[model samples]
Target: MVSKIIALSQGNREYVTDMRRYFHMHPESSLQEFETCKRIQKELTEMGVPFKVVNDIGVIAEIEGAKPGKTVALRGDIDALEITEKTGVPYASTVPGKMHACGHDAHTAMLLGAAKVLWAMKDEFEGTVRLIFQPAEELIAGAKIMIEAGCLEGVDNIFGIHVASAYKVGQVDCTPGPRMASADMMTITVNGVSGHGARPDQCIDAVVITAAIAMNLQTIVSREYSPLDPTVVTIGQMQAGTRANIIANKGTLELSIRSFSPEIRAGLIESIKRVATGTAQALRGTVEFKLTQGTPPTINHEGPTEIARAAAKEIFGEDCLVEREKQTGSEDFAYYSERIPGAMAFIGSAVPGPYVPHHNELFDIDENALPGGMALYVTYALKALAE
Candidate 1:
């Protein structure tokens, strides 16, 4: 199956590479993947694969064989971040401040490469393979919308892959459990009274309350949680009074807290709420908290991890495989794995020299990782279909 996928893709090298660059040039974010969806749908249609396109940046294509067997799915995220591209590649993003820094460009290309290969081999296989192009992965809403749209209607097992810069080219990494962390976003609003800067007692300062809450929230991770457990809470952005002299009435804080364990995530959130409440009450101000939950850790099942490891061995040999530690960075792919047993692995693109990892203006991925990524995408699809 591996040799066959390579043979099929070898002839279309230019086509596949160009497709990735095309996506890189015109980047889209989250639920607004209109043009990206159109391009993917057009290509899938041209290949004669049966597919359904959802309204908000997602597409599911199914290739069914004559005989029925286990049904499996392959997912590729197709959204870009808000960062501007500074790589200056010929395909550098045309849009300002929005780039495909997260390797979704390679992801979409690899899946399309696999789709072309699988369409040719579908007749020889005995099951169905659904190729999913997910949107809003960066926004953390694409996977949920895809699930709600019934993309997982009859799937037995599913698998997804992320392009990693940590591993060098030609190597693929997998872990049996806890590959990524769950990210929960919190926004705290402190409302108070506004008055002249000179009149200290005339107004209640929202900035004072906001600063107290932020400082106290930091303690929740360092002092409150168990010393053995790992937790991280970062205040991404903070906004308050517009001018230096004005005592603003309201201040807002946007923060993200992440943890590897589900129990830890729950506890941290509860603690955040308690701290917010206590801090606001003490400051004689009111607080409003808006928290949104993102992806759960991409936990790979043991059985599926073993299968993926074996598949990796066949391509890069036994020594080429490695196990990566849990990453605090989150992926919406957790939604799919949460529904069924699956595995999500990382493929390396970290090449030598000054290269940005992801979401950086100078971020660049090693092109050598393309063939390996294409290989895994096709091999996983074939393996899942055969199982």
Candidate 2:
């Protein structure tokens, strides 16, 4: 079965690559993937696969096997980043200021290829394979929307893949447990009395208060949390005085927090509020703190992760499976894993030169990795359903 799956995937390589190039030439942003959704549906329709649209942009397709068994789902995000193309490939994005810099185009194509393969072999299996073509992943809102729309209603296990530029082609990382961090955005505003900057004690200084708040916020990670636990508190933007001679009456700070542990994530939010409020009040000012929750940490399930690992070993050989460090980046896929047994594999797609990170205009994946990803998708579905 594995050998047959490999051959099928290899045969579909050109189809997958062409589809990826087509998507690359016509990239779309989050939630606005209407045409991308339409293109996906058109491809599925051509394959004689049935599907339904959700949230106005997501595509859910199912392939049921010959016998009754548990249902497994395979997901691929179909949104592109807001970046201009710079790789200069012949299939470079035609849409100015928008490109598939995160390898989502490849993800979409691989899932489509897997769909075609599994659709042909439906009579040989004993379950269903649900293909989730999710949108708005860049905003980390697509998965929740898909779930609310019942994409995972009867799913027994779920699997996803992300292309990585860090490792060479043919390598894969299926490490279980806390593979990615949780992200949360925060804003802090400080209010103080306005006065002349030359005046020594006439009014409170919001700039000073804001600076103190930013400095104190860093201590939450250093002094409060364990050094071994990976965490980050970054003040990406700060706004203060309007004039150099006048003491500012209001100041604002924007922050991004990343952590792997839910307890630590919750604790960091409270600590940031505490520090900001304390620092503001100490300077005779008041603070207003606001938080916008993002995706939770992507912790892979042991059972599903083992299945993925075994499948990868069979598809790409034992040495192709390598362990990579935990990533501080966040992924919307966490929403699925949080509700059911799920795991996401990182497939190596590194090009020949220096490493270019995802979401950059110069980012791209080696097309040779597509067939392996497609095979992994088919093999994982079969193994999970047979379990």
Candidate 3:
């Protein structure tokens, strides 16, 4: 079965790679994937696959087997980062200030490849294979919308993949356990009395209080949490005074916190709030800390992990399987896994030269890994449906 799936996936290499390049050239950012959806729907239509559009941007297609069996879902995110393309590839992003730096273009193409393969061989199997092409993954927002619209109603098992530059092309990482961290966005606002900058004693300085809050927040990880545990609190955005001469009355800080353990996540968030509030109060100021846009960790179940690992080994050989440590990065795919059994496999697509990481301006992947990812998805579907 794996051999047959491999042959089918390989035979469709041109189609898959072409789809990827097309998406890369015309990248779309979060929830605004109109053209992207049209392209996917067109290809699915050409293949005679059944599908429907959800929430304007999401696409859910299905290929049913000759007989009824459990349902399995394959998901791919369809969004690009807010970056300018510098790879200079022939298919580099044509859109300004947007690029598929995270390889979501490859992900969508690979799943489309798998969808075509399964549609062609639908009569050979005995269950359903759901091809979910989701949008706004970069914003971490689409999965919940997909779920709320009944995307996972009858799904028994689910699987997804991400492209990794840290490993060689063709390597696969599908370990069971906490695979990715939870991500929570926090906003901290510090309020102080407005006064002239020259009058140091007349009013409280928000800049100084903001600095104190930022520095104190780091202790949530360094001083509070265990050193062995993985956690990150980064204040990515900070805004204060408009001009240099006058003291700003208010300041805002946007931060992101990531952790794997629930207990640790709770502790980190509480500590952040405590530190921010205390620092503000001590400095004769006040603070407003709000936590939102949060998603839980991506926990891969043992059963689905075994299936993914077995299929990957059978398709790519033993050396292709690489055990990796849990990543501090968070995935909205966790929303799906939180309700059902799901696993996310990392497909390596590294290329030579200065290693460009995801979300960077020059990030790119080896096209060779495209077909391998397609093959992995197809093989897993075959294995999962086999009785």
Candidate 4:
């Protein structure tokens, strides 16, 4: 089934290439994907497909087939991160301090490709195919907004895919459950008295207090949270002090916490807030805390996972599909699958080159993974609707 879908989509390479480049040239962020939505609307119009725009910036394109079947939704986030364009490639992001480092460009393009394929196969398949061009996924609230906009009103199943670099090209890694982690954010600020450097003993240094709080926050997780569970507490940002001659009057700490189990995440959060509060008191300072709830663990529904696995086998002949370990990273698509029975997958795009980490200044994906993503999108939807 997947082989047939891939062959069909490959035949429309020119249109697919054009869509990829157009999206690459004009990028958008979060709910600000207005022009991007217009472009997608135009494409859908060209195909004579009907779609609804909502959340002031997303799209739900509906294409009906000749027969009756279950409705399946295929989602692609239409947002860009705040990272700058450092790839130096000719098709690199044109917007300053903003680029598609997280492969949302590929996502949008591939979903459009799948829409093209799905539209052409309307006569062979049954039921409706919902193409979701969502926004604010990187913010982690895009799925919820689209849901509020009734994107999944009548959808029976949903499907999403991300461009994966962990494996070599053409590889696909996804398990039946707990595919991605729960992502929540945290922040802490400490206040202290400032004094001249000549009399350091007279001042309660916020910088010193921040260092202690940071170290203890880690202990709160390692000693408090279950060792058997995967919990990550990373302080990605810290700020304190003004000059070397003056004792710091204030300090701030920002972090991202992740886990597969909600129980573990809750426990970690409680311990973190407690430690930050106590640490500040012990250092004769006051503290403030803020934590933002993020996506739940992305679990693949049993029904959809089987369809995806089978489709993958048909496309890559079984050897390319691997049951890999669960990832602590979180994806907003989890928000979508959480509401509807669906599967979120990863397609390998790694190539033989300098491996720059995600969000790094030089990260790049192999263009080869483009077709695989598009193929899987169409194959999974067709297989599920047929069932």
Candidate 5:
């Protein structure tokens, strides 16, 4: 079975790479993947796979086996980052201010390749394979939208793969348990009396209060949370006075909080509110703290993870598997995994050059890695359904 899957994936390598390049040349942002969705549907149609569109953007396709059994799902995010292309490849993105910097193009292609393979082997397996071509993953809202639209209604176990440019082309990371962090957005607004800059004590100086609040917020991580716990509180955006001479009355800070533990994540949120409020109050100013909860930490289930490991070992080799530390980076795939037994693997796509991280303009993956990822998806669904 493994050999057949490998051969099938290899045979479809050019088709997969061609589709990936097409998506790369015409990249789209989150929730706005109309052309990409249409193209995906076209490819699915060409392959004779039945599919339905969900949330008006996501594509859900199914391949039922000759016999009835449990159903397994495979997801591929189809959104691109809002970054301009700099890779200089002949297939570089033509869309200005948007590029497949996060390797979603490759993901979409690999999943489509998997879909082709599974459809061809539907008679061999005894269950169903659900192929999810999701959009708006960059906004971390697509998975939830798909779930609400019933993408996981009949799924027994789910599996996803992400391309990583940090490791060599054949490596795979299938480590179970908390592979990615949860991400939540925080906003703190400080209000004070606006007065002339020359005034001595008339103005409350919201800018000063905001700066103080930002500094105090750091204590929530450094002083409140345990050093052993992985947490990050980053103030990515700050706004204050419009001019140097004028005393600003309004100041705002936008932050991104990341953590692996739910308890610590909750605690950090409370601590942030307390610190911001207390700091503003002490400075004789008022503050408004708002938090928008985002995706939960991607926790890989033990059973599905074992299936993924076994699949990787069979399709690739034992030496292809590698250990990687949990990352603070978050993935919306957590939404699906949270509801069912699911595992997400990292497929290495590093090219011969300096490593470039995701969300960067110059980020890219070696096309040679596409066949391995395609095979992993096919093998995982087969093994998982047999269980």
Candidate 6:
């Protein structure tokens, strides 16, 4: 059965590749995937697949087999980033300041291919497959809305995939637990007296205070956290003085915090606020610290993980499955995992060249990986439903 699904997926490679390139050429951002959703709707309609819209952008479709036993949902995020394209491919994004650098384009296209394959073979299986064309993964906001709209109401298990640029095209990673980290956004604002730079004692230095706060934040992971427990505190944005010769009155720092455990997440927030506030007081500056919750860790359930691994092994050779370290990067797919048994697989799409990570303007995937990804989805769906 798996081999048949693989053959069907390979046969439909052209359609998947074309759809991926089409999405790559015309990218849309977040909840603004108006035309993207329309295109998806049109494809499903042409395939004779049944679907309905959720929260104006998300699309949920179902493919029932000959008999119903259990339902498994396959999710594909469909939002692009606010980035300009530099890949220089013929299908490089035509939309300026927007690009599908994260491979959500490939995700959507491959899932569509899987839908086609599964629909064709529905007579052999005895359950339903739910297709989720989710939006706004870049903002980590779309999955929640889809859930609120009841995408998971009857879902027995869930599976997702992310295209990876770090490995060769045939390799896949399906590690079972705690695969991706939780993310939280932080903003630290430092306020101090302003004065001429030459008058050292006359003004409180907001720049120095902010710099101190940023450095202290690093300790939350390095010193406070166990080395075995991975965590990251990154201050990515900093803004201070307008002029080089003046002591700035205010400085703001933007930070990204990530971890796998809720306890560790709480500790990170507590330590950050403590350090920032204490550092500011010592520097005779005032501080306002803010933290906003983002996505949680994408912890894979053993059931879904085994299903993915089995599917990968059955479709490709045994060596195709690769062991991978947990990722500090965050994903909104964690939302679904939190509610139901869920797992995600990493499908390699790296080409042989200078490597570029996701969200970069130069990011591109080896299109040869599309068919394998479709096969993985279809096989996983069949395996999960059978179990």
Count the clashes in each prediction. 0, 0, 0, 0, 0, 0
Q: Ten consecutive residues with minimal summed lDDT in candidate 4? A: 354-363
After superposition, candidate 5 runs with Cα above 4 Å error: 196-203, 241-248
lDDT digits (tens) for residues 324-360 of candidate 2: 8898999999999989999999999999998899888
Best by lDDT: 2
Q: TM-score per candidate, in order? A: 0.88, 0.97, 0.91, 0.86, 0.94, 0.90
- Candidate 2: where are CA atoms >4 Å away? 198-200
Q: Which is the winner by TM-score between candidate 1 and candidate 2?
A: 2
Judge candidate 1 against the unseen true structure and give its global Cα lDDT, from 0 to 1. 0.84
| lDDT accuracy of residue 285 in candidate 1 | 86
lDDT of 3 at 371: 84
Please give, for residues 122-153, the per-residue lDDT of candidate 3 as tens digits: 98999999989999998889999899878899
True-structure lDDT of candidate 6:
0.92
Q: What ranges in model 4 sit over 4 Å off?
A: 1-3, 83-90, 94-97, 190-212, 238-251, 280-287, 360-363
Which 10 successive residues of model 5 have the least lDDT summed? 192-201
Q: Model 3: which residue pairs collide? A: none
- Poorest lDDT segment (10 consecutive residues) of candidate 1: 351-360
What is each predicted model's overall lDDT from 0 to 1?
Answer: 0.84, 0.94, 0.90, 0.83, 0.93, 0.92
Ranking by TM-score: 2, 5, 3, 6, 1, 4
**Consecutive 10-residue window with the lowest summed lDDT within model 3:** 240-249
What is the lDDT, from 0 to 100, of the residue 251 in candidate 3?
Answer: 92
Residue pair clashes in candidate 6? none
RMSD values for the candidates in order, in angstroms, are 2.8, 1.3, 2.5, 3.2, 1.9, 2.7
User: Alpha-carbon error at 329 in model 1, in Å?
Assistant: 1.7
Better of 4 and 6 by TM-score: 6
**Candidate 4 residues 23-102, lDDT tens each?**
76677878799988998889889888889988568999988889877899999988887877787888777888778777
- Model 1, 41-130: lDDT tens digits are 999999999899888478999988768987888899999989878888888999888888989988998888878888887778888888
TM-score for predicted model 1 compared with the true structure: 0.88
